[model samples]
Target: MDAISLCEQYAAEHGMQQKNGNAPWRLFFRKEIFSPWHDAREDPIGTDLIYQQVLHGIKSGEYKCDKEEELASLIAQLYYVEEGPLEVNHLENQIYKYLPIFELKKNKLANEYWTGSIMYQYRRQFGVNPPDVHHVKESVVSFAKCRWPLLFSRLGKPSRNTCTIQTVSGDEYYIKSFNSQKIEYLILAFLNGLKQRSRFVIARKNQCGDDSNDLLDFEVGDLLELINGVCGKELLTETLVRGENTKTCLQGFIQSENVYVLPALIKPNANVMIYADNRNDFNRSQEATAYPQWRFGRDVLDMPLLKKLEGRKEQCNDAMTMFMFIMKYMGDHPSRRNRLSTDITDVIFKPAIAHEILRDELYCQLLRQITMNPSVTSEEKGWELIWLATGLLAPSPYLLKEVVQFLNSHQHPIAFDCLNRLKKLNKGCSRKFPPHFVEIEAIQNRTMQILHRVYFPDETNEAIEVESSTKARDLVCQIAKRLRLRNKDGFSLFVKVREKVLAIPETEYFFDFIRNLSDWAQNINVENSMLQINYQVFFMRKLWIDVKPGDDTNADLIFHYYQYLPALKPISRRTFGEEAENGNLPSHIKNLHMIRKPLTKYFQCEIAK
Candidate 1:
């Protein structure tokens, strides 16, 4: 019989006065209110902590010398009268409830050790519908079977002189070893003292009473919170307490639960205002569509977006897929669409399988539509693609590249449109696709042809010299300081400033001119008379101006120059031609040649006294 029913049976045998004569059994059985607690301890056999105590008391039939009637009276006081009927079959019904059975009988503490306020605290905090204690203990035992000896082995090994583990928040911690015994006691005390508000423990050796080896402790940055496991417990310490504190504090401060609300959900609609200057009415709307919205709320807080989320599931999934495509086409502008990138915990992209989609159907379709439409100007085409690419339907990268190449080869207006699109695309991806992309030579020749026919077909190079001179005069004035002129010798100024300017070719022409000067320095030393005359003849590129004699102001007269200089062999430049076209270089190539030609000549030029 169970505890309550056994007491009732004994009371009946002793002829104890029964109220309502209902077998005194229904007073102690509310299955919902009577669930057992999970101990989270490392024991899986021998005895169940709560049930064993009751079993022992029943078998002994000793109730501190109280008669059966008195013991029955105590049970009645403990449980409600209406619950008496449920107690009659408690022993049979109780069989369904599980309990912890410790595996290690020898080292186990008495049942009393698991009793008192700890049980109450656990129920109040974690809830009454606990896991079957015995089954949980058994599972824990199974988990510990391999770990016990392994843990001891870890303890026995020499301390990791130095080692680190990286946390998800990007902080690395040096794992320090300490005596497990000392740490065990410290943990016990820390748990005991948790009632205090400012609960801080000194982690160094000698902080606690135990004289065992030093314990493990490490620093983590603000991005992540960490809680360590107690010696024998399996609770995720940080997740429980720290997470609770976070929720509680947020609740108190905000008076609402929109703490992690994403901007993509709230705030005003991010509408693209397309003002047509050509149209007489500024208010004329060509076409308008509200951006498909993705609102953030409570569902994504406990789990990431990668989890199987419901409500707006279609929009969320399409947003991600479409956003990836848009990024590949015109480069990512996450802020433009009010989208925030959250860390994806799940593996969504597998490179071996996921092909770049932008180079495929969607991109080609857009290209065709924009190009074949005679009414669409280049500017109109650009704006349309920008809207389309950044919209919820852009394709992936590998496909986008293929589409652009197809457009280029066909030489259709679509091809030119793609070229224009490439120009307008974000410069951040320029490294990914170099300027050599798009068949630049052909594009340049085409551009020059257009300029000749449309802009100045009849003007000879000499005929435009005067106009070009005026332009170059203004240009030289703008770049005088940047050229860093010091000596009257043009060669010295060019040599000094060439590298500064050449390092970034995209800078203004004055910079590009200096860059070309640096590149042509070696060629100038060549003995070819024709090359020298060619240098002087074409030197006055359209931007060059004749500075009249008396109007001098230390002005450095330089011209815009572009050349396809012989590609300098990288190894030759570094090793100063000491290594041959196909020979193993001597070891002294670095150290011994440190004072070689360029270095020696450079230092000599600067330090020549």
Candidate 2:
């Protein structure tokens, strides 16, 4: 007589928020508060370590709670909508923060769906006149109370030797979907009760009748439908459908009239149970994961970029030419040099390697020079030989064995320091060799020497001097600050490359947006001059869902309205006469609006002037 529920029961139990109402899901995260149990008036504990450690553990993916993805989705729904619409697409980054690298890779596509799922919730709260976002679904679950219940019936004794159940309700399963086997086992436990459920059970293909090939993918929906079949104590051979329809029943019977030998699937004395929430549960485990791999960790982070190599790509004087760039850089930094970005390194390596300038032979030649040449062997000019391994040679695993032998037999300080550093790098028994990782974000970048122009919807513009590495949000914030716009969230920077319009992500580099246009335009059949003239950057209101009237005095609100007004598609235009009859005309009419420029002059005037 076992009664068990997995997701539903657990979620309902943990649904209660912390004692402090401001907190979100308890299991999702629980920040520590000063408790009465501890009597120190000052609460010697520094800034709520109890809960913060939980956050850190979860962020690192070391700590996990039941229904982790479900909890993450709930937390994401709660916190993500707090930002503007442009930032909504970037919630994938937030998902990474709360989920493990393994979990993110497993469900890499979840963000594309979930973000839009929660859009309606924010649209209501923010009166968000959101610019067109990528693939937002109309159905929103933000700020809405959700219920997750674990429903189950008490187990009854089997009669006539046919013990089984079929059909299940999908709604009660708190976790909408589960990827791990542990969760599958939990579903089985919930279905059969902890006492009756074994490590696993298999449904016989022959016993399943005509639709024998179908198996439930362990969905709780069909699992619960079994409850409908299991109403009474008398067991029945229920019809188990698959996929859109399904059933669950225990295999406890046998046919004495059939041929003597038992089949391989079921042991002679054991039950021939049939399970499956959907058609693929039996075959699901055997299939390979088709999702994208977004796994990230220490193994993937770029060390040089972390230490230095940001914008230094340009510092290698332009005169070095593609042919001698690597040589000059290596000669100058004879020692370890700062890591350069991939774009810069690719240019240097691609050309040099293509022309056989920095080939395996040249690398081997350098090794021979350092170890064999009489003057070098005598320890004179030893540093110059060591410098030969700088940027280009350091990355390769070549001559590692020879370097080890030289260090073992000889005592040369230059090789001992430089080659040893090189040796320490190649120490691991790696399968793929040195470059098994990507560079991390650089420490910082230099300031740009030029001013960038931001254009408004009305065709007017302002020029702002920003850092070379400034991000989209920073640029928007600068515009908002200068204009005294109190409402900055509704504004976004839209980049028009030729005819294509792209909204720059909030965290992306402002100049990188311009650089990307140049990069992609290289493939176009158009002229370089055409590419340069086609792209224009501007600040405009892309989302007009805001219902709040603009403030007359706040430049922020005025700027927001000026950009937002032109985009109104006018589903229903309210004429001034209609507004007057309705007594609403005075509101906008009272303000002393700025003088408008004629379209002829507006079109000709420089946007930034």
Candidate 3:
């Protein structure tokens, strides 16, 4: 409502009080002004789109924001809020993400100034919804994927012997030089105070004709080949490098005055990288989305969800399946349309599942359901299905328009109600989808979530769907199915707790590994979240005594050769006699500290103390 109407409405409701016997002010007219803050309201997605459009317009000269006054006015109109308009101190980089990427790349100083300007102008007008670590990780992954498509082409696979990862950003190119670190890993490590580096062959020497067919970067391709040859099927550790005297282990590789590929004379730092002091290193890092941290209010979104969320007789997962129960036409009500507007947090998607819904194009599946199931159904029922998919949770801004347009084209009743309700925030101010989920107390078949876990035998890890009731035997079966192993027998699901490899009982619940891990974390002075796992649920040949590891299957052969062979130690007269056979092995054979003697020697030496 305009201010005059608002004032008049107030005056009519509560009679206006006279001050100093003055005349009634009827001449005062209200002037309406648009506020970006008011429009920003609770919708970050809408605000993000608006800012993106405005920046794009400015870049295209559609918005004449060249002059200081015009730009100032535009900034004020577009971003001014009570926090920014008249404030001295403030935060930055929240709104600059909306700036044109190309324009933002003009200069470092300009980027900083503009980022600050936009920050001062806007400053989260609606709320303080900041991004979390998970959001940051997602952003990093997206940026990396968008930045270098081919570099990640061989992700979760071998780099092999000949390939140099290629990338292009204008004229400056990037090529993965070494397997010392993945690009994303290094960025995350450094950001988290674990400094690590990765070598990338930026450019090639001697111009080539066919760019696609040829190696555009340095001889990092050859280095990858060398590393692969020496490592073989095993993890390349310092022991491997030292043990194999014939292998030319890589210490460092770089190209400057002359290309230097040095052999390992001195041990290299675990997370160190060969630094090439390029002038554009800073810009290149920024381009990779390495430095700047991005934030969002919430990861999951909620808009128009359940028709009868609040109307549920019981607030449990079983209650959630009322729609299915009503499939035989048990409950019928015309008030479903009105009830759909009321949102309650009783219903939610687990975060991983929510990401899957978007990532795996589950939304498309929902649409496909509508088309496939053309059985005689009412418009209200059909709309219910449509509302569950599109309006169930607020989609990303990129998706919202398409969903709206499609529904409008089809003349679906849901289009206007859904769209209008969101922008207006009619029913509730909190339209955000709840991120965490309700852990089912009853664990009903309808509500139970299939917990997926990764089990590793060798270099490759296999995914297995688990549940609270899923036993170790069930997990083994799933692994066998996934790995296509005919001989699943005699193999144990070994939960490696730090230094210990414990075989999980066949009857024990698969989810109990989490409890075991928690216990292990508590045993040490480490936080559960911060504990770096030594190994995961390891699948290997563990139970069969007198059984040859290679005799059972190809997987057993891998476990035998790589895992067992190196760990196998022998006893001899010189190394160890029957007297000392029962004693623990020395920490190192060359150790001269405390003597690990026979049981008799311990009693003899203790009297001297």
Candidate 4:
């Protein structure tokens, strides 16, 4: 007998004949690359050989490939070049000559519809569209695209195709749509109580079904239908019709039967079961317990409801069962809950729960839960409850006074968080106690001290001359100080002045124009203040910074003379005021505001007389 015949005999003995391991199957090819002709003597029939040959050819530049096209050519040529179509036919004849496996184990010969990994790989290589769950039907069998359903089902065989669950109420839902690996990943990350349910289903290395295009949206109307089915214990033996006009029983169709499966998005109540078979197989509820003995943990033991039970020494199985039911529901059906706010407030924030859980224990658990839940935003109501509760437990202020005092200190990061919240809470509201708010005042004083130290920490006398760097430093300090007092009357006054100028049609640029000039003034050297004005005039004139009536424009010279002059002073405030015994002081002491020329006519007009 030929090698093909011998190989077929071996395959038959090894039980390599089946569609989903049912129909007889045979591996075929258009050609084959002989091992003897290549440097590496590897079995060409094996998947590894096929992969290695394609990869090696591409990497070695033999294929001259770009993306999908090149890969496809290489795969087809590598697998078929040697045997050729005629030789492959001859080999098939020889193989079947000795191999008489049952057709049930030889599904490849049944129809072209039965595709395997080899065909899939070729399609991918050739830029052919890969099949998705949507392409699958009752007659078509395939592996699942989602991992979650697989894990939850835990059957040893691969899934046939995506499942469309039909609710008794005539609603339809499609689970495991295309590229359902993400759904599996999420389920795995947060495995709850359905571990046992996994044993009853098929387990495949592939995901359970496609999730990419799967859409899940339903309403109460759909859920009621499902609940009625479960409550009535209807053993659906026919394909259930769903959507606008589906009407069949759940178990009527056999495996591999040609039909569409529909699933409902609406969550049935706990009393309802989702039927995978005659008895409705319900999904483990999200509200069900995620872990065994879950109530014993810090998350629950410290919860207010638990604390209330603890106070009464009430040890009943009913409470535990109820808690587990809720936990499971939350895990399995997150969308069903109206809101988690009530749950957090009543179950988590109760005073008794607080008393039971140690600060560290509570914090670590909250942190872990939040970190794992990608959807939990800081501003989310649930998250806020968690944040405040956690703060009170671990980072809780040591004393009521510490609440405001620590915020004033800014000695730690927590102080920043506190200040942010405090600012928001007291935004436009007037303070009931000003002088007593020593913490707020202390924080302000601390900021000012830092600025003073940065500018002229050691200068006791006011005769110190201002330097460019010192003036710049003071400007930043002053700006920061103003920002801190954003809630104060001074800031209000600044806003009013700005608004007044902006309100005018032509003078709208007056306040903003001065603010821009202030930036340049800060950069100039004190000794060259007058020269800076000259440059300013030349620059503005070049840019055509002209003002027309109703244009809200101001004279550059005037704005600079008023805004920049007052700002350009000795680093020391006293340099502008103090005088020597001879009545001589800083040369730059004269304010530029004294200049008489319109700001618009700096270089064009005569100097102030």
lDDT of 2 by residue, 195-264 (tens): 1211122331233223344433332212222222232111111122222122434322321111011112
- In model 1, the Cα lDDT at residue 126 comes to 33
Candidate 3 per-residue C-alpha lDDT over 1-609 given as tens digits, one digit per residue, 9 for 90 to 100: 376677666765676735543224565222112221132334555444444444455455444433443343344333442123433333244334334444557787765576555554334422255434233223323333343344323343335323223222224433444542454444333332211111211221222223444222333212222232332112111111211111233333222211212222223332222332222231223433342212101112221122333443343233323222223221222223222111111222222123432311333323323331213233244344334333224444565565556565443445555455344332322222321111122121233334554655456665565543356887888777777665677777887666766788887555445455544555575444433345567788664444432234555434433354333244235465553676644534455222322312332233233
lDDT of all predictions: 0.29, 0.38, 0.38, 0.30
- Tell me each candidate's TM-score: 0.16, 0.25, 0.22, 0.23
lDDT of 4 at 158: 33
TM-score of 3: 0.22
Model 4, span 444-558: residue lDDT tens? 2432111222111111112222111122323333433433322111111111121132111221222123333433553555664323121110011111233232222232332
Ranking by TM-score: 2, 4, 3, 1
**Winner of 2 and 4 under TM-score:** 2
Off by over 4 Å in 3: 1-457, 519-535, 546-551, 567-609
Kindly indicate the candidate among 3 and 4 with the higher TM-score: 4
lDDT of 1: 0.29
Better of 3 and 4 by lDDT: 3
Mark the regions of model 2 whose C-alpha exceeds 4 Å error after superposition. 1-323, 326-346, 349-448, 526-534, 544-547, 552-560, 564-609
